[model samples]
Target: MSVVWYFDFISPFAWLQWPHIKALAEERPVTLRPVLLAGVLDRVGQKGPAEIPAKREFIYRHVLWRARQAGYPLHFPPRHPFNPLAALRLCIAAGSGVPATEAIFDWIWGQGREGDTIEALAPVATGLGIAEPAAAVADPAVKAQLKANFEAAMAEGVFGVPTLSIDGRLFWGSDAHDFALACLRDPDLWEEAEMHRVAHLPVGASRL
Candidate 1:
């Protein structure tokens, strides 16, 4: 089985799942697909966590705590809510492997480096020994690839970063990794009859 990992580099929570995904790669094929979280929110008619102050605060602490628990280093960038277009494009340009993707994640979230602009990202790429950072980011092919990635993700029912899709069954959020792993181990758990039954269940009275 293969796991399609949909992610955006700007998300700290997405960064938290990097290590877990690497671990899972040892067991099965894992493809890292870069998608714009802004595009996802737009398509799903939802606001990002950072757009809600209360949730944003909670997310920061929660992600940090989770990272600590997972023994992964995490530091929020000095400025958040920055456009990750260039970085996302860069990942695609670099072939979206574990090394290149993790390098992008490490520079942005791990070391708290600024990567909002191509100028800012150039140094990070240089540090990672990536050639032609400027050309890579500016390439029209990279831009097209990123757009295609976003569109494909939307078509697959992805509404957020760090989503895992195994044979069209989606498991969203960093916390859902364990559940996705479980699903992978037991493909029979996706009982269609039970799912149809739940889907047709009558709704209880709403408190509202």
Candidate 2:
């Protein structure tokens, strides 16, 4: 069983999920499925968090509180409503080596101005031995990979970032953590959960 996490850089909930999501991988392999939240939102025709100021702030504070309880350092990012695709692409490319990705993400979310450009993401990428700062951002292959990842996520019924999928069942919220753990521990539980999810869904939704 694998857990594929979808997240947008702009999401504080994703921020909340980051620390605990690792637990699902202990003694097990959890794949990080980074996808563009904006891309998923496009298919769902939903606006991002920035559009819902009051609701976003409410959710942000709640998630931040959870992060604090989880012992993660966090602060409201300095730049509100920022674009994170450039930053996210680096995370996807970094794959298992997401220390740089976490650093940049934490720095920005901890009230830092690190999301200004793809140029800024390069230093983080270079430090990770993945690519030169300029090369990764400029490379068409990186762009295409990011785009493809987003598309695949869309196909998976992923409508947001920070989504975790296990054993082909999609869990949309941080609150679904327990069920995710259950799916990871038992293959039979996974099969049961998969059928439960499919049974609830309407016709035409296929696993992607």
Candidate 3:
């Protein structure tokens, strides 16, 4: 089973899930699917939670509690950018073994910037002990490839960031973290549970 992490760097929930989502794969066959989150949101007419006063308030309280429970650092970012696809693309090209993956998430969600240029990203990249050349990836090809990745995601029915898509079923939002983790960490239990929260978990008669 595979997990597609349709995330935008602007999503605090996506940021919050990064460490745990990676942990869920410790003993599993999961890979990160980084896509252009803004494209999904724009195409779907979905707005970032931070733009919604009530929803933003809701998420702040929710994330604080989840952070406490998850035992990880958490804070609402001071500023939120509407687009994060470029940042996600850089990380996608970055090897999975690199430490910069978390740095990318933190730079966006913790410090509240997309690290748009190589100069901007270099600090985070090297801080995480990864060598990031600001010039090498300036080619048009890199940008094109990233755009194509987003297109592919849309073809898969992805309409929002923090979307967890497995097979053809889509679970959108930060609240679905438990189901996503369960789908990866405890697939059988997910299937057996009343609601197969994650998309691909075998459900209905499939559970039996």
Candidate 4:
């Protein structure tokens, strides 16, 4: 079975996890699906890290620290929480393959550039042979595909970006990469008694 990767250009965490996910292509097919992070947050009725002041500061520092420790380049885009619709649509227009995803991620996180608008994304679009970046990304089909991606992610119970769906199981967050790899190599890991126990654990209280 193929791996389904749900990501959003708006997340630095997604950028951090991208390399490892890209490497998975060597072993198995990885489908790169771009969905709007805001849409997912809205669907789950939660605020983004950036929407919380203290959490925003913490996330920026935490990702930088993680990147430094991992030897991955880390650069914040000119702005945080910028609209990523254009970039997402551009990926759809580019066929949503590894190269296109890599270039777009590198453009935003690798180079600390602005990527919210068509003009800002022209370079990446041109590189991908999309002469009219605006027209290509703004095409009705491309827009619909992005919406469909978001809907599909929701249907799969995806609540965040950088989520990997393997064998119908979801492993979320960059921190969970190891667990995901472990599960991938040994699918029976989920069949352990303790795994089932935790999966059905009852909640004692509700936040509301």
TM-score of each: 0.91, 0.81, 0.72, 0.98
For 5-79, candidate 2 gives per-residue lDDT tens digits of 776677777777776676655556777756677778878988877679897777777877887887777777566
lDDT of 3 by residue, 24-74 (tens): 557655556666666676888778666789988887788778878877676
Q: Rank order by TM-score, top first?
A: 4, 1, 2, 3
Top model by lDDT, which number?
Answer: 4
> Candidate 2 versus the native: TM-score?
0.81
Residue pairs in steric clash, candidate 3?
Answer: none
The runs of at least 3 residues in candidate 1 whose Cα sits more than 4 Å from the true structure, single-residue gaps closed, are 127-129, 192-196, 199-208
- Candidate 4 residue lDDT tens string, 1-208: 6589999999999999999998998778988899999999999998988999999999999999999999999889989989999999999999999989999999999999998998999999999999889889879999999999999999999988889999679999988888999999998997799998999999999877
List candidate 2 segments past 4 Å from native.
93-96, 187-208
Q: C-alpha displacement of 4 in model 1, angstroms?
A: 0.6
- Across residues 50-94, which tens digit of lDDT does each residue of candidate 1 receive? 999999989888888888988988888789889998898878878
- Candidate ranking (lDDT, best to worst): 4, 1, 2, 3
User: TM-score winner among the candidates?
Assistant: 4
Q: Rate the local accuracy (lDDT) of all candidates.
A: 0.86, 0.70, 0.65, 0.92
What TM-score quantifies how close candidate 4 is to the native fold? 0.98
lDDT of 4: 0.92
